[model samples]
Target chain A: MSLELIRDILVATVPLLLIFPTLFAFTTWLERKALARIQNRIGPNKVGVPLTRYGGRFSLFGLGQPMADGIKMLFKENIVPRDADRLFHLLAPILALIPAMLVLCFLPIDFPWINNIQDSVKAFMLDGAVIFFFAITGLNTLAVFMAGWASRNKYSLLGGMRAIAQMVSYEIPLVLSAVIVVMMVGSLNAAEIANAQAGWNWFIFTPWGLAAFIIFFIAALAETNRSPFDLPEAESEIIAGYFTEYSGFKFALFFLGEYIAMFAISGLAVTLFLGGGAGPGVAALPWLSVIWFLVKIFALIAVMIWLRGTLPRLRVDQLMGFAWKFLLPLSILNIFIAGSALHLLAGGRLAGLDEKQPILRQLMEGANPLVVAGLWIGALLILYVAANGLNQLSRAKVRPREYKYAE
Target chain B: MSEQIAFWILSAIAVLGALVAVRKRNLIHGVFALMIFFAALSGLFLLLLAEFIAAVQILVYIGAVGILLLFAIMLTERVAGDDGRRMTSRGWFWGLVVAAAVFVVLLLPAIQQWPTPEVTQAPDPSVEELGHKLMNPYVMTLEVLALLLTAALIGAVTAAQGMRKPKEEGSPE
Candidate 1:
């Protein structure tokens, strides 16, 4: 290949390879610190930065913790079960880490506000990026299964089974919710989806979009196997689930994969629901868009950590039922609602909206407040009724029995 | 030149994967081989510059269908050591005969006379253009396909529920 071509390839890939792992490392520290604060304790306060004046005093509030964790993981002994499938055991972590990192390459870090500037921040751009993202992320389940089954342990097998079931169940809603945004935006390109929400036209501001976002966020939580939906790796129940047999760097790889996947899905949520990289003054200063993007991602990550600190892990049956019986139907209905609303209000178009025009513009344009509000209210009403109806259906079939506690 | 080489490589992978998928003893291995086959076909689609179809090929086939295949294989009791369950060597012979007849009648001619328009390069349709074609001209076909899939799903669910009822009735109370 030519030198210029090689340079271009590096320019695209190098940042992705570097940034995601670094982000994962820092996110671990952030999660620990946040969880600690939530639980009323100081976390990771003993590791200090080298050569700093207050290095020993405050320990830089444990800024060096992730580095310390990395070193410890590297030096830890690699253990393999005697009866384990050694080849698959070796392959699983690599399988897990690679796809999570690949998802990061599609997410645009910032849209260029300045004219005539090279907008090469995103590593790869595909016409069907949304599909690409889900397709790549779906590979994570294979890794989980490999790790679980290869271990040859019952707990690991159960964990892997739960992981597969959870992933398959949640993926439907996750894709459906994303499909709603795709329907509204009329494009599967991630950048175009983000740009459609320019100047505070974020999907989260709309009622139907808000419902889709909530569904997407919930599914994303299960997708990453976070708390409440973390039945796969529930420590108390399944002995750390699929990664039970892993140790040393392999164990660290699972954590790295998990955190990076968390960030990727959150980045997707930002791109789909929130106006990705679109903030006040982002137009005047293009670099600030990057900051806005990071802020949104970190904020979402913080909520995840908060959830980890707050909620109890859900039962496997409950988790699967919630995904299949609730989230999936809700999301499907959401797609129908969003599609009809878009066709009605904007004449099946998200773009071409005159920002200056009032919500109820000219009748001929079909972009009016009455149509928009009616659609939103109609969607919300349908959602409420559907949820209530489903709740009654389940409740009617299986009534909750009162438990008698030992006195 | 590079695209041709890539196409050849992908075709090799797809063919080899299909071979392994058919020949593998272990059901899980066979399922994974099938996944590789589907994935390679997706790569071939990408090579042909059908990005939408390529992504959908991966998304639907590898992501959903492959996982379902894996789930079925994993959940079933017939993972290994089920040689006697087969219908016998005569069945394989008949299957080969049917497959050969189909290949001769349908596949061989399609491969030999595959059409390409008189153009240097094929037009690369954007996602918008692809959507327009599907929604406008091919709407009936698309709806029919969708309805067929939905009916198949319902049939599967009904069959599963039917099997459960007989088992429940046959069990001692």
Candidate 2:
């Protein structure tokens, strides 16, 4: 509408647009290097610095690889199957990219230039931003389905179905775990949640919060179709999954979309569990909060890459059973544990701590150390017992060796 | 002016999506078109400053209902769909008549002013307020709805498992 409003919108969003794609390129390089090192090899070493002669002497740890790969992908031929649905084939990558990019706006990463803008852009200001994040994230399944169905390949179709099933199942635990944070914070605002956990008061420090964070991260991995839950794109079984028929820039778009989704979900995890932008000296220099936030995001992303390198993809039934039987029930029980813990700790009238004190300080001061320790031990033991019982109940009666023979 | 532009654009998209959803011969295409309509409807809700409703609208209708429709279609018929299939029915006239009647009935309140209760203080529309309302005054209704949904879910699961259990138990090789 107005020039100021337009400028403010750009100031808020353009940073996200630029930062994430750049991070994605870096992540691609990072993932290759990390995974390579894990498997005992050098990765992308030959792709030296651009605009330099091919001596490979002035290399940047093969940092130029993503750039070279981008160029190659750009020049590659865009292929479409003869019998595929042309419209959906064209639309699928675009659809996949939309929700991923959109959710980035909801992350509470306060850039320095943000001070210049007013409240014209309400992306981060929405009251239901957390819920909005989950809602938009759900739309990716349709894109996966679209890509799968549009390809008209049986394997692609199977990939799409598996993706939809996996995403839908994992989303329950994802949202349920997030519910613990929302319940504790008493607001769904991203910024509010972050501010609520200012300095060392991250939700992850508490027992139930720790359980929730683990559940949330695992579910987030599945939601993003990352390794260990990448049944949708299992190469050995269903080719490349939903993107089997995709090539060139369309394939690149899907890759970018998936990575951005990874960043958005991880950013959310940071905002909710890890103290978002909450670091030492952040109060002294407000601009450092953005750096802190990015550091936290990278920390989570590094863990995701680590998990990817370390684990094998799960079987379909095992995946579903873990989500529904294990994570789902565990996360639900986790909420009860969180609520009661909050009541006894924070919400109880007996507590005489000052209102302005941090949660941990209040928790320690309000109750005796012995009582708090006892409560923590009690909660952990309950969780251990519950998790063990759920595992026993959900495990198939037939052993894995017998299962393979039967198959 | 911005709001007006957005409203018109969103409304156009919604109408176009609904028409495409109803008229498409392919079930998957129709379901996706329906999702587009739902997305547009959520945009409209956002425009009305009902963020919670807008989020829930997309979350439930497009995410849950749309996927359910796709699964049902995959189960019941060919996904690629028959090209020569008719998009209209023999009773299409009556269907149109009924749809129009319902639409007009729904639009009547908008066309004509109606007496409504007025409070001195406008209620807060923030999510916090909504939660408070739900947990306090409307908790009974909310719990009842939850109960109903839970029953339906359990009933559906039992019905699905019912068809398989007898076959597994009674069959002898």
Q: Which candidate number has the best lDDT?
A: 2
Q: What is the lDDT of residue A171 in candidate 1?
A: 91
DockQ for every prediction shown:
0.58, 0.82
Q: Judge the docking of candidate 1 as incorrect, acceptable, medium or high.
A: medium
Clashes of 2: 0
Clashing pairs in 2: none
State the lDDT of candidate 2 residue by residue for A334-368, as single tens digits: 98987787677765553555433344535644577
lDDT of 2 at A140: 98
Scored by Cα lDDT, where does model 2 land? 0.89
Best by TM-score: 2
**Interface RMSD per candidate:** 1.5, 0.5
Q: Candidate 1 residues A168-243, lDDT tens each?
A: 8899999998887787667788888888788788889777789998999999999999987899998998899999
Interface RMSD (one decimal) of model 1: 1.5
Candidate 1 chain B: worst-modelled 10 consecutive residues by lDDT:
B80-89
lDDT of 2 at A130: 97
Which residue runs of candidate 2 sit more than 4 Å off their true CA positions?
A120-122, A346-365, A400-407, B101-109, B113-123, B160-173
DockQ of 2: 0.82
